[model samples]
Target: MNRYKHRAYNEELMDDLTAGGPSMDQTLRELETINRWLGGNFVTIDGLVKLLKKSPSRPLVIADLGCGGGDILKLVARWASKKKLEVELVGFDANPHIIEYAKENCKEFKNIRFEVQDIFSEEFKQREFDIILCTLFTHHFTEKQLTGIFRQFKSQAKIGVVINDLHRHPLAYHSIKLLVNLFSKSEMVKNDGPLSVLRAFKRKELVQLMNDAEIDRFTLQWMWAFRWQLVF
Candidate 1:
């Protein structure tokens, strides 16, 4: 199948698979497992930290686009706190349920705020965020949608945008299946995990997509088994 066709198939399949509502606990646990598997080597977080350390004069404002349940936002918050940097975090997700959960679960962090807004919508201010970070997301888009999203990111971000996502490979697909079976009992996870890996973009594919989106001045890096990063 072509890339777009495969992406559509994966999207439909995932929606069907996860239709029954995987509990917050199950979703968080699966995310934790995935994070551990990725070795907490989120290049976006590390890259933002590097940027902040280099420029000590300004406080950083970061938006976690598609921040489901705020797991990665919490990590970003914790990392920022550890680095003793002043960071204003905004977690944006299309899912209202996830936004509510994030607000309640991550209430301890005063600097982090959750908002229900579509990343593609014009509701958010343009060029307001210092860095826009997306994690374990973006595979849901085709090249056209990706280009549109990048345009929005470019308009909404002042310094740069960071994208972290899975790299599709047969090995990664099998690994996800094995790991999900080993760690989770949710049928939604068991089905969606492997499909997500299959739907993920390869490193070169992502680079080409970035190029097609006219995002030329960015650094591409890989981590652990399948995670890839595009830092601008």
Candidate 2:
């Protein structure tokens, strides 16, 4: 396999989705259902808090890349409120529709801001945030694309970047496939769930990606049967 192949979502796919040929509402609904089943928010937020506890300074600004419907942002907001940790959250995604949905869903949290950003584009500012989080989103990128993202992330965040994504394993793949079918009937869930596992990274592959991106001052760990974390 060409590890450096650009497998991330292409402009054509984004254009097609933006053009309104398919039912976006249905797709979003399915995505939400799949996320819930995967328990991604629970795993990611808990892990983040654990990591933050070890640090001396509190994170003032956090950017949740690939924010999707802002579900994870909502969880982080709630957690921050309980901890009395004042934080400003910026949610970014390439899809405007998804960003709009995130905004609407997270309207109750005044601290959370949602915007459309292309991670691969030069328009994205650098070194402006305390932390940059890419959750359940990295599988979209191939080695080369991941390298570019990590470079951007390193330039943008002073503290470090947190990457919470899937891990590819045969057991995990089959389990999630069955779980999605048993839990959700959304076609999008059924389609993307399996594909996500297949496209996911292994621990060594993730570590190598970080190294290839020149991110040496960080640690990577795996959890939740198939979730991986890269923390610095």
| lDDT of each residue in 109-147, candidate 1, tens digit only | 999998877666666744378888888778877788888
What global local distance difference test value does model 1 have?
Answer: 0.74
lDDT of 2 by residue, 1-232 (tens): 6432323243223233362214555566666666676676566776667557654455479889888888787878888888778889999988888887778878999999988888767678543787778887888777888888788777788766778888777787788789878876556666677777777877778778878988787777777757887786
Full-model lDDT for every candidate: 0.74, 0.73
Clashing pairs in 1: none
After TM-score superposition, the amount by which residue 44's alpha carbon in candidate 2 deviates from its true location, in angstroms, is 2.1
Task: Find the candidate with the highest TM-score and give its number.
Answer: 1
TM-score (all chains, Cα) for each model: 0.88, 0.85
Model 2 residue 9 distance off true place after TM-score fit, in angstroms: 9.4
Candidate 1 TM-score, C-alpha based = 0.88
Residue 172 local lDDT, model 2: 74
